[model samples]
Target: MLKTALGRYINNFKGFTHEVWILALITFINRAGTMVLPFLSKYLKEDLQFTYGEVGWIMVSFGLGSMLGSWLGGKLSDKIGFYKIMIFSLFTSGILFILLQFVTTFWGLCFAMFIIMAISDMFRPAMFVSLSVYAKPENRVRALSLVRLAVNLGFTAGPALGGLIIIGMGYQGLFWVDGITCMIAISIFAFYIKEKKKTSINKDNIVLSDLPKSIYKDKPFWLLLFISFVTFMVFLQIFSTLPLYHNEKFGLSEFQTGMLLSINGLLVFLLEMPIVSTLERKGVNKIKNIAYGCFFIAAGYFILLFDSWVGILVISIVLLTFGEIFSFPFVNAVALSRAPKGQEGQYMGFYTMSFSLAHIVSSKTGLEIIAHYNYQINWLIMGTLGLLALLCCFWLNELVHTKKKS
Candidate 1:
């Protein structure tokens, strides 16, 4: 009977539109490569014997490249096409992954990571563009939710697999596996996925700048982007610093760290949408949700300042994950709704820049904090930043509400 219920659930998922499924598959594969990142600091520090400063520099290199890529990728897609941009991004990032096998020096790894991040980020703007083209307006939220599910599922398996590979073969072997999987993903996309084309009549009616400029003028629109930057700063810490903290502070093994990260993703996979619905039903504005998320995030890390047991560590992560789901989707939904009638692609491109900025800041900031102070001190500081973010959200709520009433 339980098997029958699970089967029904699986079938329901499969019944989504073909475009949504295609995007989901592509997202899954891309995210599989991405999941290795959560453990990268550990691999670098342990296997390569790199200093915290060097590790921080490497991440900053990638962030710098990604920032440029995010802005250009959107405009490029507008000039070329989303399908072509996606293919380019996949193959280019795959090659960079394969090249990681040769890097031993700090500068070499930085160069390779920067190239990989820049090219891979080219896909970011295009994904939203293609999704807008494919999904009906009414079905877009569900379509995006399914794609996010694929990301979580992919990470669930990928990081665990990455941990095993690192345990058995070391970091080089993990990079090789990532490169191979990415190549397979590219081939699958090229051979099996169909591109959804915009009708010429529809294209003829719209000017390229019309949509982008309109979105820029909306005050709430830019405020949403700023909040995204802050959220990413908080989120990136999970990937870039937390693993290092676990290794140094708690003396966690690679496998154990992988399990902890997996727990964070698992809760999102299971409960994100339900929580979003609950908050929305309670008449919570997006700003309020973002504010509450920030507060909880701060509190969770503060809780960690005192935690010594693995079990308590797990609880802190659970608290952090709840904040993540609330802030992430709520921010995206608010931005998407505020986008001009036909400018989702442009707005999403602008939106992605926030991530680029956050990555840059977190990579550099996290490393500096660890080097100058200590891991515990760094955590405390980030907790403080979370409070600042909460305050920003309240200011944002007032701004958005006033704009609406006007």
Candidate 2:
């Protein structure tokens, strides 16, 4: 019975083209090498002796750059091509990461963070569109999930590897690894992955005119964006504030903290694709799935309110992992599939920007709250935000159904 189930699970991954697999592999290498971000907050606070507020501001710089990059990547992918942007973003950012270790001052670091992130995050929206170019209509959702799996798989390795690197070479080692990985990841793509011409393909099967062409005017899409923002905000906190919480409240070492964080990635790596495939096959409502995901995420934060036992930490992360697995792939599918064929880059670019915006809010607000209030208070606030996102999803669902009937 177990073997049958395992075989069934593996079956969901089979249909993707070689290009999709290559894209997934590229995403994995790039993301796996992303060791610096998971520990950036701790590095800033502990190694550089920066205050929480300072860290918040630097992250703001990082996020603003990410926002700018997302917009540019989308725009450029439309105007030039995703291929050029991907090459430039990774290669430039790789050089920047190595050089960033030199700047220890507050303002200098802030400027550096913003510039590097702007270049790096350009890779995101471009990559999202690349999947559209590479994947077939039938295989698109799983293709997106494959990339997410790569991300989580990379993340699964990143925190654990990062922890060891920190121990051996201190935080400086993370910078070098991060930088080298970016270049290596891009080099593989540059050498082997030729740029494919964008074709007039419609993955959603619905008429393009049925959906709003302008992202700004699409009310349902706005709600989806808000839902995505809340999800990213909550998830980003684990990397930003939660590490500090583990150190101060739980008295866990960097290695122990990495292990705890790696659990989230490991669970996602193992579960997300199968879960995503199952839901798609069952013809589940994407909005409803996202709403439930919101509840799980909120509960993850709410559980943090009971931090007496170390076991609660493990349980909370489990819930958060479920929340992530449910919402993210569907969100990408809905956005990417609905996009007008010629303007996919704009739609996905803006979609990814929501995440970057959430990163800004997540990092700065989380740090500020941690600095001013206690961890419980911060957790309480985050949980409330998750609930708000849940309510919004419900509203969006009703509106979408109402429109369909009209």
Candidate 3:
């Protein structure tokens, strides 16, 4: 019975198409290469003797890089082309990671982190834009979900694997591994992945003014974007403070903390797609799912307030995972649905930018709090903000429904 069930699972894996698998493969490589940093806070604090304020500033620099990169990458996608932008981003990011080997000072590390963060964030909007262009509307969610799965799986493996590397080879080995993997990823994209639309085939320039005003004028989309913005801001702060919390308050090791962070990715890897499909079929409104997600995430963060052990942590992880599955995909789907025909790339740019902008602001805010006060208060404030964002999601849903009716 066990063998038969295992065989069936293997069959399902084989059933995935070449294109889909290729997309997932490249995404996995990219994410795996990038996973070094989530656990780097512990390294910096313990090994390098950096203070909380120093780490906060370093993180904020990364956020600044991401904010600028996401914005420019979007515009550059229009001017230079998506695939080309991706090529530059992947290679440049790899080079930056390798450059980290020589860095000793806090300033040097901050600069390196900035370059690495910018290039990696730039790769994403372009990649997603390409996915939107290539995949059919009906299959888009599934395709994106596959990519998401690759990311989470890579994230799941990367940190746990990274923990071992940190243990055996030291912190610098993490960067060396990441840099080499990035090169491999770039090579795969360069040789294997072919764009559906060749840039050279189109000479006609698409002006920003020619784009749909719906992105600006559509109240529902705006509301949705705004609500999403707030929640993302709240959520992104967790990464900035959580490592410090575990180290100071709980005395958790890098491996243990990495394990905790990995739980978030592992949950998404196991369940995002099945949940998306089931909820889509169940007549559950997408916005409701998103709102519920925010509620759950907030609740999960608040649960951390009680200082529970593994069992309670598992419960909190479950809540945040469900929230991530529902909210992340729903927001993306809504953005795609709202986009003007043939301008999917542009819309996805703005869509991604919303999250990027939120992340930058939130990280900066979290840095300020940690700089001034404590993690306990910062987490509480962030959790409350998430609840407020959940409330806004209901208003966003009403607007979308009204617009659809008209």
Candidate 4:
């Protein structure tokens, strides 16, 4: 009976096509080399002696670039398709990383960082489009979960390895390694994966008047988008403020901080796919699952309020990981489900822009809060925001349900 259970568990991973696996592999390779951005705030403060305000602005530049990139990538993918955009994004962004290593001045660094983030982020919408195109509708969420699994697995390795690289070779080594891995991902895509051919639509049957309305005009989607932006604003603090918080409050080293960050990835790697699959099999509602995720995220932040102990930190991360597992992949699935036929890229792009928008506000505002007050207040604010986001999720659920009934 135990062996039969084990076999069933193993079989849960078996149904995706070769292209989906390739996409997962590419995600793995790129994310494994994700060394620079996670460490950028630390590098700027520790190495370059930048002030907190300056670091905030630098991150703002990155956010602006990310927002613009998502918009442009979505628009361009709709026009030219995902393949060309993916290839260009990977190759050019890799080269920009190599160039970024040489930039010393603050403005120069900002300019380079902006371009690098913009180019690198273009991959998001293209990848989302590719996932929808390659996977069957029934399997798309599971396919995306596989990709997320690869991402977390790679993330599990990247920061730990990056810590060692930082100790041995300094910050420049991070850029070189990241650039090389991006090229490796690019090669995998160019050689192994052929873009899915667009199915031809008959012009006679296609009513120009019946084309999907612009995303701006879609009220429900916009509401969902707003909720996404708010949730991400809370969620993204893990990247922006949490690192600095760890350093300041707990006096953690770079390696220690990296390990702390990796805990979230480790938990997700171990649990997310199985949980999501099991939940789906049990016929759990995705929207309710997401609401639960929001609550857990808030709980994670709330936990941080009591102490700076290592044990508490670990528990906080665990809660946050559960939140991520429940929320992120399902959110993507919902966004894809809502998109009109032939407009996947545009919808995905807008979906991605929500996170980019969060980056802009989360980092800068988080730092400003920390600069003025304390980490406790920051956590409190984020936890409160998470509760607000939970309410938004419930509203979104009703909105979607109403639309379907209509």
TM-score of each: 0.89, 0.97, 0.88, 0.95
Q: What is the lDDT of residue 345 in candidate 1?
A: 56
- Tell me the whole-model lDDT of each prediction, alpha carbons only: 0.76, 0.89, 0.74, 0.86
Q: What would the per-residue lDDT of candidate 3 be over residues 155-211, giving only the tens digit for each residue?
A: 888877887888899888888888888888878977887756623323265444434
| Pairs that collide, model 2 | none
Misplaced by over 4 Å in model 1 are 1-15, 198-216, 277-284
| Selected candidate, larger TM-score, 3 vs 4 | 4
Query: In model 3, which runs have C-alpha deviations exceeding 4 angstroms?
Result: 1-17, 198-214, 308-310
- With a 3 Å backbone cut-off (N, CA, C), the pairs that clash in candidate 4 are none
Number of backbone collisions per candidate, in order?
0, 0, 0, 0
TM-score of 1: 0.89
Q: What is the lDDT of residue 301 in candidate 2?
A: 92
Off by over 4 Å in 4: 1-5, 200-212
lDDT of 4 by residue, 183-270 (tens): 8898999999987765555567755554447767777778778877888899888888888888888888878878987888888877
Encode model 2's per-residue lDDT on 273-312: one tens digit a residue: 9999999899999888888888999999999999989899
TM-score order of candidates, best first? 2, 4, 1, 3
Model 1, span 249-366: residue lDDT tens: 7888888888888887788777765565455557677778888788878877787778567576787788888788777767766766666544555677788878988988997898
TM-score of 4: 0.95
The lDDT of model 2 is 0.89
**Whose lDDT is higher: candidate 1's or candidate 2's?**
2
Worst 10 residues of 1 by lDDT: 8-17
TM-score of the candidate numbered 3? Answer: 0.88
Q: Give the poorly placed runs of model 2, Cα more than 4 Å off.
A: 201-208
